[model samples]
Target: MSETSDSRAQRLAAESLAAGSPTAWFETLYDAAGRGAAEIPWDRGAPHPLLAEWLVQHAGEAAGADRTAVVPGTGPGHDAELLAALHFRTTAFDVSPTAIERVRAAHPDSAVDYRVADLFALPPQWRGAFDLVVEVMTVQSMPRTVRAAATAAIRSLVAPRGVLLVIGGVLPADPDPDYGPPWRLTHAEIEAFAADDLALEALDHGPDGLRYRAEFRRSRLLADTTSAIERTPC
Candidate 1:
């Protein structure tokens, strides 16, 4: 016997709530998403509002640059599409083959290139290739031990004069040691995480100053002029 629409919906919702971590949920989604699932709840359907707003505000500045944007952990490609629409040559990746397949099918003609790449195992050819590195709720999904490695991988993607934008959510309190794949990063912790060669350009914590947007710019490249200037030995 076939199930009713409402019954199927109810069953899926129940399964999701019981899934616990978002990562586990993604695994479930990968299996169920098929070749082309129209509506995944985590999709958010449209472009990310914060990113869209920034693109609109910076349209003029971005238009003149030849920049490549990399979206790590791009599940269903909403954010990648948004970046491409804004004129950035964007590429997005996820470890899940199913998720990558869905994204590629959805935007077949788009400039966005959806590839399957593990966060840490990015192709060497892509190293230092992006002018913009985006981490949208991706890093927090990892265990604490690998967080540093994840941060390092993101940093490596940015060119000397590039930027990194990380959008992460917050938990009610400190995340329970038992509950995760959606770790909450404190503002201080984030600052420390990206402290070495990147500096915060703009950080908005919003009303509560926790769940937020953090933008980091790679330290300015030391130009060849430094050697030229040193010849004078003043």
Candidate 2:
């Protein structure tokens, strides 16, 4: 008996699964999408505008002069580069192996450490090692069912007395609900979550008013806490 093409394909798919691959279809999609070729849709071809704006505003103002910054779902590593340039020790990660490899390739001399790591299943060693956690459009890219978990994981990465910088788009007053991949984060929603364990330091206009730039500080209290309300706060 000889194996047919169909049988071979099945075998390969089964092997990939047995090897703990992401999804069987991932390779095919990446192949057609030119995964490592650069110019990915999520890539802005430079550091995100919101990230740049925040760095400019607080590059030297953060209380702790020496702290580690981590960028989850770091695509082309532009934001990580910006953090490193600002003198913070930086680590950037992406779930996609191709994306992580691309980051390293695109920035061979970058001071940041680029790694392949899932946002939800971060390595236990990194549980609370970062003083700054930067999340840019990552939660939106995930399934809605996992958004809360995604938010928790991101929050968990922040060290005590650290900050979380979130840059995302706004939802319509009455959104269609499913029209997302750019999931809108309502202001109320942000406050609700951040209030649970973090303090809202700033929720200002990002590069553009349409997109928001939010900065949160981890609460000092073991119990629930909230930051001072600020309409024009930092």
Candidate 3:
């Protein structure tokens, strides 16, 4: 019997997870998307509500103009485009070259810079480079062990006094290992970003209770404190 699409995706996800390279399936999915074979479930064709709201609330702020923003794992670039619409210097990257190509093809005149980049191996200059960093549904797609690294990478993109916004699916306090692809993050995992000078400003669950949006801020004082502690010698 032929396998169904859902089953195929599940099998592929399991295989990728077991191989400890969950992002490998993203290339397959993007290739399929390019061929019009599979739809990317999270490509909403518009910015997510949390992102939209953030833009609305912050766009009028004094420093909003000329702000640098990045969207890591930007699959199709809707959120990146939204940032550009607000006049941010936006850079959007995806691990899949095909996905980056599709987004560029879809929006030829877009101001957002769309490129292929692995989160774990981003350019050295990208460290602490953005005034705003948005990660949507990217980290949860990876295997559990990789989530910490991914989260740290996401955290590293925020410059001092900048902000990080995260939107992803979340598990209940107690979660089952087998429940994934949209792997569910635990509260502890979400809170972990607060380490190393970043501060968790807000964490809110979606109305459906299956997803969450977290905001982290990098403050100058916190960065200085961390630097002082590091200099003090353990």
Winning candidate number (lDDT): 3
| Rank ordering of all candidates by TM-score, starting from the highest | 3, 2, 1
Cα-lDDT of candidate 3: 0.79
Candidate 1: tens digits of C-alpha lDDT, residues 1-234: 665433443355345546543234454556665734423544677766666655666676455247789999898898888788767888899877888887888888888888888877889988878888878877776656566787787778886777788777765564674355455565565664355566665665555544577667777522321121111100
TM-score of 2: 0.77
| Model 1 clashes, total count | 0
Worst 10 residues of 3 by lDDT: 225-234
Tens-digit per-residue lDDT, 168-213, candidate 3: 7768666676667767677778777776678876676666776677
lDDT of each: 0.67, 0.68, 0.79
Q: Model 3 Cα displacement at 197 (Å)?
A: 1.2
Give the TM-scores of the predictions, in the order they appear: 0.75, 0.77, 0.87
Error of 3 at 118 (Å): 0.5
Better of 1 and 3 by TM-score: 3
What does the lDDT read for residue 158 in candidate 3? 93
Q: What TM-score does prediction 3 earn?
A: 0.87
Off by over 4 Å in 3: 1-8, 61-63, 220-234
